[model samples]
Target: MNYRHAYHAGNPADVIKHAVLAFVIEHLLKKEAPIRIVDTHAGIGRYDLTSDAAERTGEWVEGIGRLWGKPLPAALEALVGPYLDVVARLNPDGRLRFYPGSPDIARLMTRPGDGITACELHPEDGASLAALYARDRRIKVIDRDGWLVPKAFLPPKERRGLVLIDPPFEERGDYDRLVEALGAGHRRWATGIFLLWYPVKDPVAVKRFHAMIAGLGLAKCLTVEAIWRPVDGERLAGAGLVIVNAPFTLAAACRAAERPLWEALGVANGRLGVTGDAA
Candidate 1:
């Protein structure tokens, strides 16, 4: 209940997550049909990088900070452009001050007819999120437990959309919960895209997670991982996303963008991979 993302906003994990998210959303936008976005565990939509919490951690220094204004290879430019465009709009002055969370990213990528439902469990964060989008008719903010999101809102009216499940693993057994939630959601919305995010702290736990998902019999599943450092101790060494029903072109785009992303993030030994049939 006390997990706050302000300290880690715009960090390496955010970079990878948002980059993939941007690519996915851009792909979805290709179709003329209106799409919906459901962000479970959505934090405050926008964050000020100069805030006290951000200053204390300064995590962005190793994340978006390194990528700002940096040139990218031709292959990666298209894949990562949408995300960087959003960040650029937020910091038009060319100084990185504000950082957008998943909800904000969705808002930026979505078209007029598309909609978003963001669920934030933290009371204060939820309030801030609601306030941030109060005047935006396309967005709906909900203050509730993210775990119940599939039950309350699945099989969206659009019938074509994305579900981003990014839970803060502050509680024990969160990994198990994530798998269960995804399975349940998949059952209800078989064709919908599902992106489940997790930290790569314990390799064993991550392996178990992948095995569990693999056993689910999902025909189209891809695991994208960005490992910046060795997995050790309690600190986060990397981030991962299990993408079910991924777009056909997403895997190739991710592969091409991996090296450039790693270099931009200043990680010499960073690793990126796409596993499962979708790859």
Candidate 2:
């Protein structure tokens, strides 16, 4: 995989995705039952912002750096508190020196009995991930393809949890593979909450994804996207997260979050919107 998350960690898209992810995990804490989190395509748990990769890209400047210490809207701030708190803990002086990937986020909120299975395919990243949480009894790090692992580790042991699929869309076939993965994973663990992340490059691709999910005939499905700017038929200007069996609280949380995030990180010509059906 040519894509190294270190270069893009904490970017605007990561900000939105991780913020919503934290909210979902927080909501899960409300129930007394044990919960597990299965992260497909998990990257290294953490990244040093001063490293060559991160410094070369400097994407965080428009992301976390944009609002690190700013006053956020009360609702958005509350929803993103857990995530920001973790970031703060990582960068104690609030200098934005470290950034956490999804796996780290999952690890951060794991409880005593809670379980987490994170899969990373990149040899280097996988090794770093394994080392990052080696002593954590609640987390399991595996070097393998996340899509295939979901089939083997479905309906997690706790019987209550979330499965996050965040494949690097370096290949065009990813769109098709995503559909297959979702269908297979759902069949194995029908009630499990599944969150799939995708980039919005072409308008047609986005529509196809929407239609694919709608065609699934799943009743409680939601699609939320934050567009930083109009697609120029070139580079990716935005992305979306498709949530299946999403919690009712997430929609409002996402709605309350889009604007502040956009105002903070969006380009001068950018736009932001969140929409979906969840009940």
Candidate 3:
């Protein structure tokens, strides 16, 4: 795969994905017990919006850009504060320039007892991720296939934490691979939280995928999404997340954070739904 996340960094998909990510990590941090964070398919830990790649897309202009300093409603702010806080920290001068990937978001939230494993299969991205946290003892960067990480790194010794699988979907089998990864990981760590991301193109295919996951028999799960346009056909309509063993409060939180996204991005017909134990 020749995908470099930099080109799409801070786009609408990322806003929802990372917002939910930071939200979940913050929830995991509430416990004093050591928690492990594994970011499979972790991209370069951080991004510079001024880079040539980011400039080519300018997707951030409609993403984090719209929300940077905008005043938000209380509930929405509470839901997305954790993520925006990281963005704010990266832009102390009150200018949007830096964006943190899943690894960086989790790395900053980690306490001494908490540890993070960031795995990136892309060669250059993996090396960049490794060097980004070279001095950070709490994070261990691995260059390996994320699809296998769940099996190889499941049941984290910490016994409690999050597993983030955000593949680029550059391969035809990625959805199948995600299903297998979740199944493999759950078998080893039934209680560990698992968060996965997928694009909202092809509504029918998306629903079929959701049903397939429900059949996997996870105890508790929910699907949260934001659809800016009609979900009638295949296109980059929006973004969605499938979270297994999610917090009881996550669905409501996801709902709260999603609308503001459409509002901020000036998009229409923001459709959000698909929350349930397995559906």
lDDT, candidates in the order shown:
0.90, 0.83, 0.84
Off-target runs (Cα >4 Å) in candidate 3 are 232-234
- Which residue segments of model 2 deviate by more than 4 Å? none
Best by TM-score: 1
Which scores higher on lDDT, 2 or 3? Answer: 3
Which pairs of residues collide in candidate 3?
A: none
| Candidate 2 RMSD to the correct structure | 1.4
> Candidate 2, clashing residue pairs?
none
Instruction: For each candidate, give its TM-score against the true structure.
Output: 0.97, 0.95, 0.96
Error of 2 at 260 (Å): 2.0
- Candidate 1: TM-score? 0.97
Winner by TM-score between candidate 3 and candidate 1? 1
lDDT, candidate 2, equals: 0.83
- Ranking the candidates on lDDT from highest down gives 1, 3, 2
| Residue lDDT tens for model 1, 114-198 | 9999999898999999999999999999998889988999989999999999999886588898999999999999989999999
